[model samples]
Target: MLCGKSLVNNFYKYKRKVWQNVIPIIKRHNATYHPPKILFFGTDNFSLPSLQALHRNCSDRLGVVTSFKSPANCVRSYAEKEKLPLKKWPIEPSDCSQFDLGVVVSFGHMIPANIINGFPNGMINVHASLLPKWRGAAPIMYAIMKGDASTGVSIMKIEPHRFDIGAILAQREVVIKPDVFMPELHASLALLGADLLVDTVNNVQERLKEAKLQDNTNASYAPKITNKLTEVVWSELSAFDIYTRYRALFGYKNLTTSFLGKQVQLLELRIPERELLVQEPGTFKYQKQRKSLLIGCAQDSQLEILQLRVEGRKPMNAQDFNNGFLKGARSLNFTQNKLSAN
Candidate 1:
């Protein structure tokens, strides 16, 4: 009923339903445009693309501030290669105040209020998920694990104490395909964020004014990835659910299960179209002609093993692994391997 006149306002309200591409807040910045002196913060490959974008756009990039802990990585290497001035974090607010604006990406440290307010233009973050959702460490991984249809990068101005809860300047989404994995999604978002960041920085003043407040009510946290979360519980979660998590956390956190008395990396898990007779969940069934291992799961789903890595060994085709390891065995239980170890 009220969507026409206040579409912008309504888009802010119903952010999830609408593919709201928050068009640049068009307003005249009658004053001459001066490229901002940006203080860039980042620590890894995820932050590299955005840093490169800033360097290409802004002439006076103050320096790179990265984690002292993650030194000698991509950010440091890139800075040295390009001869961009670089410094380690735990830097003083007064020092950060020198720059006209602060840009952060994949920099794990929280910028204190003084540093955030230090920049005359303001500090901005290029986050991997849409604001008010997946607002934590591993948004990309969580989005895939949770089986979200789509997720996007968010550009938002920073505030004290609260993390990722700020006025969103811009957002651009990427659709999740049925078979998308970690590296593909990560690279896509990194590039998308870099491009979006360039557009936002080119019009800092208008974006600040147009930045919309995030709805706290709809906010969801993507807690940091942990070892425990990577352990596959075949009986508790269905084949599809486990497959999705395997897709999401593969590179960073290998989905592992003790199989045949060895820790095996589940590189790929896919549910076949044809259903099989009911069997105990987590029991493996070998098909000689197909050269595949069919693992029964909840909801009558069976996981076809495509790829895997045996502990202390390189990844290989699951068929080869089945022939080599399974031998004459038809099926094995998850607990079978665990019990043997104990």
Candidate 2:
């Protein structure tokens, strides 16, 4: 009896695993009975390329809804330039009842529950990171900053009044190289997202059967990017941390630090092997031999400056910055007296 019970338990476990793997595929297959008329919503450079791809590939069936003239606007401008059928609406309009599916790609705004429930097929979100892990704004940057080995895109069903809690229709893993920068990674993920989206839409029912529910217990939050997070805390972080910060904010935002009573933004940085004993953490050390600006960190590591921009000066290499700007720049003193005075 004991042996028989053990065998039955093992068989059930295996079946459970198979069921978990097969369910989403079955759901997606069932969902694809009708060719979905999609509304693509997003406004950002990241979303622009995907919009272009969808426009070129799925033009007959896809419509676009995007933000107005904002810093992050992507689809509206593209629609205007290409003269494509586009609607600028933060909320779903009265005529939105015609759309079958809502596919959101890098749309910054949090869609309301009413709009999510309006569609018969259901809304879908193309999240940058694997779901239930990095679910919120700035997933790519946060993933890099946290030094994740791999991140992926998730195609999830948007449920009413929920945040990233929908069933995942499909996902594709993306391996991060040690040397990959933020811009390149973002572009690669965006393209990958587009492909996954198309596949999910084409095989909707089969993919939905394979869709998996994320573990609520393991859920983590990715808050929106803020100026405070962009500021460099040199005294509390190591050189490697600083380097990651630089990469995370590159192009979109800058890693800012104060120097000589002026704020300087570091656009890029490298790490050198050579050690310096004199300069304190957060202080700048000029290496005449290597012509590098070695900035001391909270840890023993030294940050080799590659490119930097001063408060009012143009961006330049460490050597050029030293010669042109730092020649007259005073050393920042983070002492109590300096803090009190400032």
Candidate 3:
């Protein structure tokens, strides 16, 4: 038994470990039922765990269906490892009809209506957000990018028409922390979705009655993320806002902030505890003595740029980047590329 001091220490130490322990919950569901004859539809790492959970817990699997896309070839590796049947895209309705059920997780493509009707039980999807919210591609990143305080995973029956517009089967909510980045959040939700998926399969008959129709009235779409959204309009955003955006977008994609037309790639940044004087937003202020870089934002907040890449230069830390260009400069006008030697 942990004493008071050790108890507090363990709590801090295992706080993240606690989240990592969701695999057991999935394992528990395995024993309760025979594996459903599932045809899994997925292509990326996000779908990997759910397929694994199904392979472990459920038997009589039909196979895995995937596109031969790069960057998300985990499905193929997994199928080979498990010695499971693997089928590529343009799948026919006949292929889907052989399974007792269908499961989709981050599959990134729609299951056609012909395939939908083939399953006697129809299809179930493990979506990363609660129904009617973040109901599209890129839910994990969008939740963080929009600064949502809490987001969740939802297991829903698939509608033939679209993605994530179905009735809710189950949901598990997680609070967002300022420090949690996109990859961390993505991983957590994947495991959570797996747990929910197995539970939904076991309780589908009973759970369907409890399934709530989504309130389309409150629906907000999380559009697919592209390079265009990576553009940081510094003057229009707050430090806190940009910080959240950067956190969500950085690990998985490039984050570039441009002034007028010139782009600067940010390798890293941090929000410090110290406050700065109010200044016009988007002003870059550097301290030569302290070897610091501070950029002003809305609400008088400051963003400390720790690492950045100027054009025609390699990435550098604040102390190093300041050496040649920003040593004596106080403030630089980003638009005109003018130094405040005035």
Candidate 4:
């Protein structure tokens, strides 16, 4: 027979043994076992989803860090609205030393070595593309422009001096629907990135331990969008190429060309099923039934110009444009001008 004190001692020993075995399992699988203190860095609307996710998952969110070059920084607005702490860029290393980790999304600034070393767990970035593929400032734009079949989000460590050259901690891929345009794709990728970021940060240590280096041989770049890409080279680009460019540049810039000695912007465009009678690229014929302009393009392809705006004029539908400007004009042509013809 066991004494009372002896029985209590045995029971405690058994409980301790059980817990010791279970603790490792719990830590391995539990996402919120020990939420890390996070310092978030972001500036644009694209960064909002990640910050919002971290706030929901982490109880120890320290603050937001951003260098606000634009007047409309959504991250700054969000931190203010939430009454969370906010720190401008170029923060001192000592200030963020207490934080366990740093999260960057669309921050657009190179973090210094001292600042990256402040966090005990180091910094991770939520990039909008599957890294090594489109690694630069405008991954989303280039992905849409290049008409890739698929794209995804990448969670990676932040290496100093370079943009997006980091070991990937995690990644999640999404399909690019055939008819999907830039704004829709951008929104979808942003939300997907946010979810992946939360999951990665939840088990960051394990993810970091299992990080994989990107294959530079298979790497590609997405340079910043420029005004030159918006120009419509009618003689050089196929109708499909023009339509793809329009889809990619939607909500960013419209395709521009010179029409009848004036600069004209192609606002709304569609791919035409049947070719027009005109064979020369850039020539157009107004389709009476369709209420659109069938414009010739390279490789015998044709595009429907649904809406356009001539220089110093309000945007008009194809019907209105034809009625107002193309009255009695059939063989009007769009030209590649050497200078601004406005």
* CA lDDT of each prediction against the hidden true structure: 0.82, 0.77, 0.79, 0.87
What TM-score would every model get versus the actual structure?
Answer: 0.84, 0.81, 0.83, 0.87
| Candidate 3, 204-256: lDDT as tens digits | 77777787899999999898887777666667778888888888886777667
lDDT of 2 by residue, 92-202 (tens): 545457777788888777788777777767688888898888888888888888888999899898876666888899989989876677898999999998888887887
lDDT for each residue of candidate 1 in 1-342, tens digit (9 for 90 to 100):
466759977677788444334322222332445667898999988999999988888755558987767546798888888888888787888877668899999988878888888889889999999888999999999999899999999999988887788899999988989899988999999999999999999888899999999999999999889777877767777888988998898678777778666788777767777876555778877666655678877777778777888888889876788667777654466543343334
What's the best-to-worst order under lDDT?
Answer: 4, 1, 3, 2
lDDT, model 2, position 102: 84
Off by over 4 Å in 4: 1-32, 276-278, 328-331, 337-342
> TM-score of the candidate numbered 3?
0.83
Model 3: residue 188 alpha-carbon error in angstroms: 0.7
All candidates: CA RMSD in angstroms? 9.5, 9.2, 9.6, 7.2
lDDT of 2 at 156: 94
lDDT score for residue 226 of model 4: 74
Residue pairs in collision within model 4: none
- Which should have the higher TM-score, number 2 or number 3? 3
